[model samples]
Target chain A: MVKGKTLTYGVLLGSICLIGAGIYRNEVNIVLKKAVNLCLECIGIG
Target chain B: MDKRILTQIIATIAMNGNIKGFFEGSIFKGNSKKLCVPGLNCYSCPGALGSCPIGSLQAVIGSIKYNFSFYIIGFMSLMGILFGRLICGWICPFGFIQDLLYKIPLPKIKVNKKANNYLKYLKYVILLVFVILLPMFLVNDVGMSDPYFCKYICPAGTLEGGIPLVLMNESLRDTIGFLFAWKITLLIITIIFSILIYRPFCRYICPLGAFYSLFNPISFYQFKVDKNQCTMCNSCSKKCKMNIEVYKNPNSMECIRCGDCAQICPTKAITKNFSTKNL
Candidate 1:
């Protein structure tokens, strides 16, 4: 269906744009900041 | 025994390839942690090489400075559109564990269809409430919130990250408290249920699975049942671990695209197509 194709391509394009925006905003560092440390909460220590 | 299981093993090893961390009792803190793996891997796992999207999303949303994460959302969306729950079927370490557990000689319990239809919605509710709302809305005096799902619900985090870390670190054992006990209980229940059921968590608990299921109908990679070759044998439906009626709806939200249906189809009526032509 054309609708499915449109939605799929639309989402793909939107994802690329969002990724670009995230990089520009230095959001990767946010993930890094959290992941690099031992998350006691994630381990259910808290 | 199959390519899918082999792929699962390779992916599990690939994502948690920091084998040294398992021995050291410390999680990997390398630059690779910036990337998010496509499955429900815990970032806190001792050998994990990448971040978990759900946890990262919660962190960003729960932070005072931000209520959204463009990178994680984008990454998850891309994966969802491309492969949907194929990630659940093939690559997820937890999923692989469940598959292996289900292979045990224990009798499987097939949930009632009516109950299953309703229970499947619980994952969506969990995604909205625990993964999104609680983290975004409930904050401490410092304007920060907990990763609610990871703290309270995720057996993957407890099993992959918690138990190993505790077993390795004697100091951490002293900090074990009610939450840890609760998580351990949950993990035990999940393990037991996994033996009696095919992917009980994936069917009724995993928010990540719920997220990916939404894209099944429209994902670039999809299933198509050929009308010409179809015999309506219904064997595919009977064999589906997710309990999907493949011939009736090849692109059901419940289908993980494990290719079991395609493999079982006597006439090879089912095909995994790369085209996004029909929704």
Candidate 2:
């Protein structure tokens, strides 16, 4: 049970860390650029 | 007052777009829009100070040139691990709207467990198809793809961003077409269902909810049923708004950690936060 619990926690946390590290390599800026747009088509206005 | 009310107020205010632009029906174009809020808020909502995570995710995935969003995935992963679908119960603007709508006096719709289980799978399908596959594969000549979920579904965006924009701007009114009409129909149906059912969207259509549900069992902040104290009288299960059998599965993906079961538990058998009960 302890091993199972540890494995779950470890994998989840590890993936989070890996993804977190990748964010600095331009993922945030790219998302931010898109987000700043009104995305008129998204709300069916365009 | 409920903690939910307080969180709702804070989230609303925090996400509230610029008041002048909001009243003028202009979506915020500020740098703050770059940030993603944890819950399902529409970025184009005139009052929205931050971006919707799902919208941001779709936009990133649907970009002409694919750029996987490490930032969004990481942020959401962290949130899921920390709180799971408690974000639905406590922080989501759309979920708050549903909660208020459900509180209105109306005949309710209660699906049987078997049907409910089947419906729960819909959101996962939406996540898989609309958010992921459609955007990833169905690209235009320029390689950009539509954020299909936002374009076709997501009543939240229609409610928060669509109706307001049309009401506030004469020019945008002319832009409304079959797509807008379709979204309006979806929005109206969602609102009516919310009044008659407990979070119908959360239970069956919200891809974001589906994403968070995946982490409910192992999430750090959720509830557990104390086997010692639980007498299996079914009081907690009855109190659940999400229709979960709390005693049988305190950590069920459907359990939103709303604390209703905890408040009503006859033997005080429910406890919140991390614990060995999950193990």
Candidate 3:
């Protein structure tokens, strides 16, 4: 039962992610690019 | 007894700005200083003398308003490595509020034991996807301000940080929009839930707590278990608000080092030792 609950939660969280991605694809990409740049900048390469 | 006093003293020092000028909001001149402090204390909070590192990190990476802040990360790492989750348990003003809230007379609900273990991982997901990854990638520039945690989550930021700042700053009040209202709504929900649940944010949401848990096993301050004095009565687990089995795993990720287990140990087996030997 516990394993089942965990699986359910995993599916639910995954679905949320998928939906979020579908709705916010461009926004997510913009954020991701900025994040990558920040990380690179942190290492003094950006 | 002395430990609580020490914790209180440390909290006082951090709050009152006695030891260093940094604690009094004097460190970073610009907005970058606002992006540090791993704990949830909001930088804009009237009482907060220091910065909220998570908020700052998100803002630096997420918004089109700021630049990347190396100083914030450096400051946060210094605190994280030095005391780890100790701040979450002791120093954080928001943590203090939750501790006070749990004192109210109510029927406390513990998460189902079997399902509880999995809940510990949620904070890590929040840390990765929301706190770190999202801000870094979502912004127009590498150093733009996002405050992603505050915008999407972070009841503390909403309550202690956001509300007060907006109230005090007329300029912020004038610019309030749908996003601010959304955050305020999240804040209200969290506040209401916190009154009934014991450290709800710490248990299931805080990204900072997730970071600190990674260091718990190796952090200088740790809970030591003496197996010889074994009476597996489960009393310690019962006393825990975080719903962790203290005897089974005293240093478990969910263990907030609130000292309930140490205080209730019938055999006096649990001890919180602040030494690098464990590391």
What is the alpha-carbon lDDT of model 3 when measured against the actual structure?
0.61
lDDT of 2: 0.83
Better of 1 and 2 by lDDT: 1
RMSD of each: 0.9, 1.7, 11.1
Ranking by TM-score: 1, 2, 3
lDDT of 2 by residue, B55-121 (tens): 8888878876454666677777778877788898888999999999999987898878899989999
What is model 2's interface RMSD? 2.2
- Candidate 1: which docking quality band? high
Best candidate, DockQ: 1
Question: How many Å off is the CA of B68 in candidate 3?
Answer: 7.5
Best by TM-score: 1
TM-score per candidate, in order? 0.98, 0.95, 0.73
TM-score for candidate 2, please give it.
Answer: 0.95
- After superposing candidate 3 on the true structure, give the runs of residues whose Cα lies further than 4 Å from its correct spot: A1-46, B1-13, B16-35, B62-75, B141-145
Can you list the residue pairs that collide in candidate 2?
B16-B47, B17-B47, B17-B48, B64-B144
Model 2 per-residue lDDT at B106: 79
